[model samples]
Target: MRAFFWAAWLGLCSTPLLAAPPQGFSFAQKDWELACDNTGACRAAGYGVRRGEVSVLLTRNAGSEQHLTATVTFAQIEHDIPADSTASLLIDDRDFGALDALDESHFRLDSDQTTALLQALTNQRKIEFTLNGQHLPLSSAGSREVLGKMDAFQRRTGTADALLDKGDAGDDAILPATPAPEIIAAPVLHNAQPVPLSMLQRQKLLPILTPLLNQRCDDWQNQAIPAADRQITLTALDKTHSLAQALCWRAPYNDGYALWLVDNAQLSKPRLLTTEASSYADGAIVFLHKERGMADCITGETRVWDGKTFTPSLKYSTGMCREITPGGTWMLPTFVSQVIPRQQKEADNLALRTLYNAVLKAQKSDPELSLNKVAEQFPLTGHITDFTLTYADDTLITTSKPSPDISDDEWQAFLRSSISADSENGKVSFTLIDLDGDGKRDLIIDSYVGGTGLFSYTGVLKRGDDDFAAVNGSDSDNGDDFDAGVPGALFSINGRGANQWNHWVKINGQVYALWYNGQFGEDNLYLLRPFSTTSQTPAVTVRYRYTLNSIRSPEKDQPLTPSLSDGDKADLLRSLEVMQGSLLKDRPASDNDAPICPIPPGTSADEADNYYSGVAVNYIYETVAYIPVWLNGKCYIGTIFSHHGAYRHGVDAEITLSSPREDEEVIGDYLISGLRHVIAITSGWKTREGDNGMQ
Candidate 1:
């Protein structure tokens, strides 16, 4: 690519003059061209080029402390112009009313009393200027000279010293020195080795030469040459030639000797197309065809002679052939085996059906064994080329290309193995016996190896006493001697026989051992004993059930009376006082670590003031033991001292015990009514005492 450069002149102005009338300033062309402003605080200078587009602007502060400004006279190349351009500054935030533009190739911003000018010049691409009235020339030649001088100075003083000095000398102006030219070495090109034509070898040999024979034959029809020349050509075409000679000498073959092609251009050794046996067999009729001037095709007879008479048994045809044995004899039947229609057809159908059944059974049995068994039983024999099996209801049918015979054993083995349970831990086992005492035998199976353990299924058959016997048990250790300890046990119960039961022995233990029993309503387990103790009865444990009401009384008991002695009474009263003070009204408290009386603020002297009052009556009887009783339901138990006098007077004598008060009704409804009254009495006494100064 291309390289581009950009430069911008931003103007910032001090507060505009607002005093007396300001003097005007003008800029001469020479001053504009030579002067450069370094402060960067210069007023806006218009007449800068931007991609060959130009603009002029006048700036004035609009209002406010931020010094908002508006453009008064703005002129610039329209947006999207396809050239270098310059913008004329109209409104800058700091300047109140100013005009800025480029004049004489210099940036100039003019105001009433202040005129700022930037003496800068630019070529077609970029502008170059120096700060503080320092002029910088604007030519490639000037840049090269400056660079050369600077480079020479750097060589004289070293780069570090030159950079430190930077062509700056006090009281004297300094300019950058020019740089020296640089030289680059030319690139070298190497001669590459010629690439071998290996990729084109096959294409040139095979594709090109095969068609050349016919093309050359057609070329013979061209009669433009003289008759003598044609005869010479015909004579030359009748000679014996090798591929190498044909390409080198361009000669055709003779009818006597076999033609051999050779590719001498390739590094490989030359090859012969016709062996001596082939030459003898075909009587020298061999030809080598090569395309694109390379050897490819070799044509000769297959039979070879053993230095004697030529063999004539070689044959060539495009069809499939298979050798029956290692002696290289093709498998082709010379005689067909005769078949009786009825028997052969029946056997074929049976074989096909067996295969179909085997495949269908594989879906439910061990898939691998099912498939192999099918192949073993109904093997593809005779002239079968393809076969298919399908299902119809519970039966399986098969269609064969050319069906064959299947023996009875093969069919039976296929059915048996297909439905047989898979071996467990390399062993096949199952058990049957009555396990639930429901008369029907339960079947237990162990189909997989490594102790698939045992699984039991209840049988549908029933026996006497509604008992069900386990019909099968395998690899099970269910804690019963006859049923549990038996491994691969298959039992059958004879309801009519004298022995009544017969089971196959699978485990190594005694055959008469009772692994489990269905005699009881459920499975009865028995531990295995030695043969000597097999006749002894086994120990057993029984379980029972009960209900909750039989363990506790049903009715609630009456509360206990106050039975404290004089000393205990005093202690109790003091304790009650402390409890009342701490107990707050409407706020319940736990009896565990209950607050002492002398009730806190926001509390009451009623039952509501006592926290432990609402606890269960039985719980209170267990914890406190005191109860308040009423004689006539009014002012009797827990009565205030003033009410105590009325209780001592005629009211106590006349009141009957049968009457109940409204507050008594409320207290009776709660489970802890007795404790609630005691707490209320204590709290009431404290309230009265606090009022009487006894508190």
Candidate 2:
């Protein structure tokens, strides 16, 4: 890949730098190579203890639209570590909870976390990532300079990504104010409603019509009839009644026509329910098919048409979601009965739910399941790593890294005597983790027996005064009942290996069981918040659903911080203007002053400000790539507070900038309604690393 990238760069350099800047730039910073591509894509990549192995990578996307990412990649592992397992990062002895895992080797921090990490990487003398039982030290040598170079490259590419404070000069973001509530998306409704033909014809409905047209035939490649003769019908579908009436035979866009619907009472001018690929029912469920790679990503909305207005349902879907409602029918593996049968993979939630439930049951029933077994079957599948053992203070006791001195017999003895006294006829696998938030390290053990059933004994070994003891749980001892592990289907199949239950997750002040529904790469987090009780029968909220992007949606948006007074808002905005000076160009201001923090689509900046007040709200990494539609062929720099369009008004999209305002010039908060005005796209406010020197 390096050879190919270099070759591409060498070829691009033949051109002049007049129309565009230099195609590429490469320089060495600290022990890292800071490289930038023609489009301003830059990366500060370096190694840890081992060379040639990527350990830390900081990327700043300075293209048309800006995106910044930070990654810490771990070394190789021999055993499987659950991706959901908690891995702690110690920056000069202070513990920052497990970094978000992009994979077992690579972990990506969020914008806030990345900001904190960049600071630590630049200032702290020591940094260590503790996963399973392994203690991986990351050298901070030259990291500060590397980050500086990263900022320089970003500026050259027009990103100006991060304004990292000099040395430990700014306030610590280690515990920045509790983050603001994520803007939760409205509940998305997919059920389609029928509407009258008159409404559809008068409104020129396409959102409803396209699907029915698609259902009528496969594609428009071989339509036999022309526009005039095609039969167009309209259906009135409601909870109470449903009927269809034939409409005039006409098809727009030179295509055939089909039955369609429109919400006549939903909007000011009878909005086209079918026009936006929306499912009409109460109001309209609008969606768009965003193509990401070969997979089709669905982002959409659920809005209810009240008598007067179209209200957002606040439930929506974001990220790359497969049409689990299969387009065509096929056979799928089934665990409904003891005998494995092939069932039709129908296009409905029932089939998918049934399959998931079966997998869960099988995981519960499979006693001999082992993490090692699953690892062998599905290599590189989960956030998996080698088994690790650490001391009480998270110091490394032993790891799965192969030693040069140990023979096979000696290694076997080491495995047996590491933590447990005896294997007791099962494979010995253990990890150092902290279940009850004490400073001491706890043990997670999987003592496996033979058979694809519940022969495996797995549970936590809470640290005691002398050694570790079995946790006071029903499945602590060799028992029939225990969550065999996540991905129960795999557990049922490989019962004789290891248990891959993930580590615990603490939200607010409570710890809960966290797991993933889908396989690796495709992530769907299930945060099961457990209600504390002494009784063995547990009560949990069952699940909290989200993809990484949808973590902060409108419905889920909460004020994780205190509210700021108008005075505080005014003062902070003034201070922030100083930082925006670095990114703003010399341009005339419009007659109207930019609103303090305008929240478009009916919400004001003040409402949003109150909604997301305090230090947390001020530091939101909401940057956007906006084209300054210049008046008379000139560009002006300003901030873009919030965008309200795509998939029902700024639903699950992200907008973050590195340096929004600098030099006493604030980026105007103009909600650009049309695209014709935009000329150059760049970052807005809510800059990265440190928010206007406020950390």
Candidate 3:
């Protein structure tokens, strides 16, 4: 979940400080810091940054009936507090009562004490603790901002359970808690030995890994390692794969090692999992890092191998650095998962089957077969992780496999490609997978069905002797009640609405479809079973229904429009031309492939680089081209375009501009200002007047 959120954040926050608050984030103001993890739980910590003072930690779990908890620990910079010392809480110079000792220097506040402390923090009253005849005052410089962010993150600003803004609204609408996902670790091959890279192997593999190391590892690129220190070790993961480890960086307190998954036969490229890992053993990697030099607070992460890849199994952070306890005060986990051993998985599955059958019996339904057995019997193969689309003779083609010899841009524009199901001018996407029992791969194309409203039409094409062909016969004899058929099929699963969208997730070689109706609505999970032939359409069963209402819509603060001067507009046009030229330069040699940028009117072939050479005012008919953009595990096919300008029929690639400099670059400043308005309008809050481009 964190990985998905990170990718989305990268796409949205291309520029620093110009992005909105992400789904989950760590925000800090002054000495106070509020960290809202991926699971929606929030932890706010406050202490003096310059001096050792009293520190407090406030924690609130997601969902209703979850109350806020407060804990405090005395800051000991140079000396430790006496074990027998008594402590008392004071608010505005008024002593409430003796503090309950949680440890030698840490204290837990009672309900009444916590309430008074909250009031004091909100009212700017002094909060202090008297321990061993010493007064430790807690700073309140950034408490309000940090607390407000927490309330906003939990969607409790207007609810009765809100800590900052009390209102009449009920707390029932507050975001619900999401259970952490579970990962079962595969057994490690303890008998396998680590193989040091030989000189010949190093010479063969250094070119392939050097670029990745230079980008992801600090020690390899920034600091020169001695001949004795430089080393690479590979440990066998399975018959085909191995784990490669190398030193990443070194600090005063800890050293980080980079971990990568490499194919033993060098059949595929290496994949870097992390660069801050500590150790790897028993099919798991542990990461430990100190937050401060005092070693009072630390953060830890663990990733477990689940056969296919390294899965994030645990993530936690100890409370603020108060020196009350070594390795921090409390174990505050933002991400956690149950790890089951390989031997116990079968037993776990049996228990789960019994529970599922019990639920089905309660509903008067027949006991269904074990989903695990179904997954194993019909495991999906040739699952394409990603693909690029190009055109051949005005028809869209799917390029799932690319050659390593070609550059990224050139590989994106393929030479010979499989024709898509539709040629209509709309966003087209396809994936390659073994749909039938045949070992040959098949194609599943998603295209826009022609209509006044937006609709997605999915169809399957089976592999033939030479190329992919439509399903041979009608799927009406499949004995399923779904609105599915051969060749051109609607959504494959049952109970799916017209507004719903689907994305496939592969876990342990089995493919499952997560179908959702809206941005914040119920999700239908479906498992696609393999079929013997094209005529025998794969059966779909709804495995579970997940109600997703926790993710809320962001509040819009301004409109989407840029205030650009004539000079700024000219600079933007020039910048766009340069970007378009670069794309054309690296484009593969394909005359029929669709080009993102078209040749402008009256532009010669030799002068294609200057397509936007005319005066900026002349093209004041600047049209906003809407293209299909994939973000956050969903594809948004844009249909809205400005009516004021002529619509250009081609892909409008997203442009990333550099930071603005007063003396040199004005495109970044003006373009970003315009983007701010555009972002606000498209945020789904309210549309700007006379702007019909938002959906």
lDDT of each: 0.23, 0.34, 0.51
Please name the candidate that would achieve the greatest TM-score relative to the true structure: 3
lDDT of 3 by residue, 1-695 (tens): 11212111111111112122234566668777777755566778877433566777776756665567676776665778778778777988999888766446666677678788888888988888777767778788889999999899888988888999989887766766543344667766765766787776577667777777778777865435674454777787876778887888877778898888887777246788888888888688899898767777788888898888988876767656656455665455555554655644543344334333433443243222222332333333463533435555545454444435333432333222235443245455666665543565566666554433234556666666556554422221101112222233424322212223455534444343423231101112232222211111112222221111111112244321233445544544454434322332134535323323344467555555322221122121222232222223222222111212111221112222221112322121111211100000000111111111110
Candidate 1 lDDT tens digits, 475-514: 1111111122122223222221111111222122112222
| Candidate with more favorable, higher TM-score: 1 or 2 | 2
Q: Which stretches of candidate 1 lie above 4 Å from their native place?
A: 1-268, 275-695
> How much lDDT does candidate 1 score?
0.23
Best by lDDT: 3
By lDDT: ranked, best first: 3, 2, 1
Model 3 has a clash total of 6
After TM-score superposition, the amount by which residue 503's alpha carbon in candidate 3 deviates from its true location, in angstroms, is: 42
Each prediction's RMSD over C-alphas, in Å, is 47.2, 26.2, 25.3
Lowest-lDDT window of 10 residues in candidate 3? 676-685
Tens-place lDDT digits, model 2, residues 1-695 = 11112111221111111233324455555555565544344556555544322256665544222344565644332233555655656677777766765334446556665566667776765666676646767666666676666565444312233545433322221111111111222222336434334654545544544455455444322345553233344444443222222222223322222222334354222323333332344334333343343222233344443333334432212211222111100111000001000111111123224323433443354432222222122122212223523343322345454544333543444444334422234235554544445555555555443333334434455555555544332211011122333110011222212112333444333333433221111112222222111111111111111121121212235531222345533443343334323221222433223323332466544544322211121222233222221222222332333211111212222312111222223222212121111112111111112111101
Per-candidate TM-score against the hidden true structure: 0.10, 0.25, 0.44
